[model samples]
Target: MTKPLTDQVVLVTGGGRGLGAAIATAFAREGARVAINYLKNKGKAEALAKDLGPNALAIKCDVRATDNVASMVREVTETLGAPTTLVHNALADYSFNGDGRDDLKTLTPDHLTSQFETAAIGGLNTIKAVRPGMEEAGFGRIITIGSNLVQNPVVPYHDYTAAKSALLALTRTAAVELGPLGITVNMVSGGLLRTTDASAGTPEAVFDMIADNTPLRRVTTPAEAADSVLFFASPWGRAVTGQNLIVDGGLVFG
Candidate 1:
């Protein structure tokens, strides 16, 4: 749809560290000028931008706040040109430890709210910010990071899974509305990744068990999942939209 990766400006939310960082790195590797958005990990973001070369930059923004997101997009546009690609990878402070997660009765509304703010509302803000630029150019690529738990909730991550489900809904609906404008919206869902700051609390035994059960016999890594995100942003994905491609090493199938 848009020009090749070398001619694109890409913005990735929560791109300072963990899986977000991996996704940013992937875009940079493909020669895209990338904007790394971070809420708290400024140091990491700056360092990543530096390592990615002059085509990349680090910006601070809280995607949950619409105003903050608008400012960040403006900065990216000013610094790297209007972003023709976007990746909604921001995540609330969360852990994947099933034992420590709240059960159905114990989960609070606030938990759901926090997750929804980041996964859904944050996505809404970023998408809106970039849509205009994409529409002007008549081409855009949008990819959201989701979780396979929505389809196979093996650990019962109620709040996190619920929010991700809503994001999936947003991704599909946005695709339906944006497709005519030459914008493709899709999602890349991953199961328990081997290691990310968010999943560091996950027990070693859990990883081993997941690896044993997965058809690949190994937990997916951040880079592997990041690669899937890249595919959706490339010309190869021009015909695909409103779809969630699970990148969990075949742990669970749709």
Candidate 2:
């Protein structure tokens, strides 16, 4: 069996654990050289790279900083090859507890900016870093993790939702600009994953509520969502770009 990603070098930011880790594993399974980028949690990142075997490496970078992102890409290229695929999964520290979340009155610009720094701005940094290599090769795939909350906003996670929305807009516009160069930009939006560090704080009741209401009768798993990200990178997705693929098990319909 042939895998389209076998010849590719992939950089997955914030790929030390949870959904990011799952995405790295997916790429590794396809025989792609995987660079697991992490800002902290060195042990988790290294452990995952080791588990992915010889072709994968763990790297560190704060995607919000262009210089750091550039350096990170250099290291990845030197070690793994110029990254032809990038998944910007790095997220700022945040908890998904609705009760503790900032409402309009309590929400400050700082709160939103913090999320934007990692989600929106970080997405920009990675894309720019990889643009030259992708343009040179005339082939690239850029996938950014997004949130279904942008459309549903059931719980009103203002900061998080706003940042993801911005990323989605970027994905579409970048797709247009990069299309001529053969690089496709897309977003994969997932609802509260069954369990991740970010969503672990959610009460079990909320999970049950989501499951009971979702058409699939279950919450989306990190691995399941990771597979959707895979679709946007594979050859089958070469013609698809600037589209947001929702992986929330039909919980929120468009």
Candidate 3:
């Protein structure tokens, strides 16, 4: 296989499992040295790193904290070389069960704040840490993981959806701000991936409903969603910035 990302170092936040893990694996397959960051799940992260060979490193990082994110980026730079690609796939601590109990009235400020802190603020922190190194190299690719719920708010994952909506806005602004430095910012918004830990609690009926509604007539997989991230990281997406590429099997077209 041709290695398009040869000699590049990529960092993926929340990369121990689920969509994040898949994204890390994809980058590794493309010959990029990968730093897989996980808040917990050290065993899984280490195992993935071992599986991906010498070029993959597993580090624990809580994106919700700026200090942790900065430390992780520093470690990556010192050990694996400065990261030219960053995939912000972290999510706030929240379950995916859309029980309809968290509407505008029932949702608490804590919930919203926590969500924004991780998805939006964390993204900003990561971008800031990586941008300087990328600028020094004159090349960068920053991909933020968003959700299709932002486009079609039918699902009542209020906190998650709202956080991702804000994340999309941040992505656009960052793209404009970082464009002059040869860095590109983009978003990959995917629908409910079937077997991720985040989606394990979702009701079966709700999953079925989403599958039925999707033009593809099936729920998406973590691998499928990860492919979209890889696209943004690839040379093909060099000119694509400040755009949200929805990867929901045509479920929510915008």
Candidate 2 on 139-214: residue-level lDDT in tens? 9999999999998999999999999999999999999999999899999999999799999999999999999999
Q: Candidates sorted by TM-score, descending order?
A: 1, 2, 3
* lDDT tens per residue, model 1, 1-254: 55788888999999999889999999899899999999999999999999999999999999999999989999999999999999999999999998999998899999999999999999999999999999999999999999999999989988999999999999999999999999999999999887899899999999999999999999999999999998888877779999999999999888
lDDT per residue as tens, model 3, 195-223 = 89988888999889988998999999999
Clashing pairs in 3: none
TM-score, model 1 to reference: 0.99
**Ranking of models by lDDT:** 1, 2, 3
The candidate maximizing TM-score is: 1
RMSD of each: 0.7, 1.6, 2.1
TM-score of 3: 0.95
**Model 2 C-alpha lDDT versus the unseen true structure:** 0.93
TM-scores of all candidate predictions against the true structure: 0.99, 0.98, 0.95
Question: Model 2: which ten-residue window has the lowest total lDDT?
Answer: 1-10
